[model samples]
Target: MKDFELDGWDDEEASTDAATSLTRTAARVEEERQALTEQALAERITAAVNAARPGVDKIPDPVDPAGTGNLTADEQERLDACVAGIELLSTATWVAGKSLDTVATGRLFRKLVHKLEPERCYTTIEEWAEIEHGISRSRCSQLRDGWQIGEVLNARGYKAPEGQVRELVPFFNRHGLKAAVGVYEMVVQAIGADKVTAKRLRETVKLFPGDLALSDEDDVNVIAQSLAGAIEGATPPAPKPSTALPTELKREVDRRSVALADRLDRGRIPRNEVLTHLLAAFADERDSRVFDVVFERMKTSNS
Candidate 1:
């Protein structure tokens, strides 16, 4: 090879060295900030735990796990209040999860464990996620969603029977809590609070009439027909024959039909009738301005 002059090569090397030094400095500063954050979180959790311990300890523990016939009247009342407080704390954690970033949440979680159980040592969040089957950061994210939705429901004056509230979370999250409250009130009015099981609530929500004018009787009839079909040979009026549809389409229709059947506390409705109602609803949606606009846009873009 011919001899070459490496002109300005020393300056290039010096520039590279300066860049590396800046990167190292940035990394060091980030690490220090993270440590400071964790320390602050730990201190906060410690204080809260210390504050809560006294009242929680004073509340009498249930002698019977079934919580029946084991305590005086006053003791039972105290236990109920104590349990309510615990649930509130759980709700607060879930609400906080929504606001905190991942690293901050992990720090908070670790600090909570330390404050709650000072006698035991726990591993890092990563190790815990690995060791526990099906437990991960995503699960924590979902937990936050659940708590936030539950609080929304509670705020709307629709509290009690938490399972029912939970069943409607997907609906509330999708349609908004105010809309959910409307549907919930209608359902409670039609079925009564005593009959409102999760299955019943979910099925009722599925058939929500939207803008269609469906009264309580119309809804109650669907449930009644479902119950009637469940009984052997106890058929309602025969439905008109359905046109042959694609297999996937048939499966979806059948799924909704079965959901109605399963939700009924008492009677059975024909699958064909359920399909008819669904088709009517779909047609109504398809004919609406929103669907027309979307369809026109698609056609225009394709052209």
Candidate 2:
């Protein structure tokens, strides 16, 4: 009787434990179902926000969907700003200080207006390229000739020399810029590529010999100042643009002054090429005669 009574108690205990386990499992399943339902609702909310926002590409998918990340008011502003036109233009990283020439300004304004119109929401890379190429012609040629010019241009991205922001200029125009290539390469060439090799340019620009692929800004600035001195004939050993060609070739400049003087010595730099780089880096035929006379005098003095 005692053994049978013990078996009966054991059976009851086992039945109670099993019942408790089943109840817990059911509770867990219901909890999971509710969680999933909440997740679906949150996703719907996110989708609605993204749909209403005009130009944004992504919605923040918080890791804990239910845990509203307790974003501060400022953070919420940023998030909400992502839904408006002000946000779209504010977030645009480039074009801050880029110059807008007569033609370029029109294109930019038109695009900006179109973008702000709410219904129009996209820009093709091709159209951007066309604008880039239209105003920036030598950018293409610099890529072809001077290895450094393109490097500097790309490194600077849309940033210009003033460090405010880079402006757009057409290639081959030579409006007022001091270079044949885009402005960035002009700086690198004006200084030393080693001193001015901006990492930003390196990534986008094609690398070249003495390309200044890894230099700091301060060093480049000093070197550029020195180069300006040399070019102006103020503080150089001399303007040996061949050695100076980094400064010259860096910008893919015509280097007519260097070439003209060089051809005068070797008779290789045709008058046309001289006129091309330095119409003033050279002189007229009368000046040429005086140069010849001075050359003979120097020879006689040395003899």
lDDT of each: 0.59, 0.44
TM-score of 2: 0.23
Candidate 1 regions off by >4 Å? 1-58, 62-71, 82-90, 93-97, 100-135, 160-162, 189-197, 209-303
TM-score of each: 0.34, 0.23
Model 2 misplaced regions, further than 4 Å = 1-13, 20-24, 27-30, 33-37, 44-48, 55-87, 90-164, 168-303
Candidate 2's residue-wise lDDT over 183-301, tens digit each?
Answer: 34545564544454344333222222221222233344454443344345433233445523355453444454556567677644544564454444235564576556667989999
Q: How far is 158's C-alpha from truth in model 2 (Å)?
A: 15
Best by lDDT: 1
RMSD in Å for all candidates: 26.8, 19.2
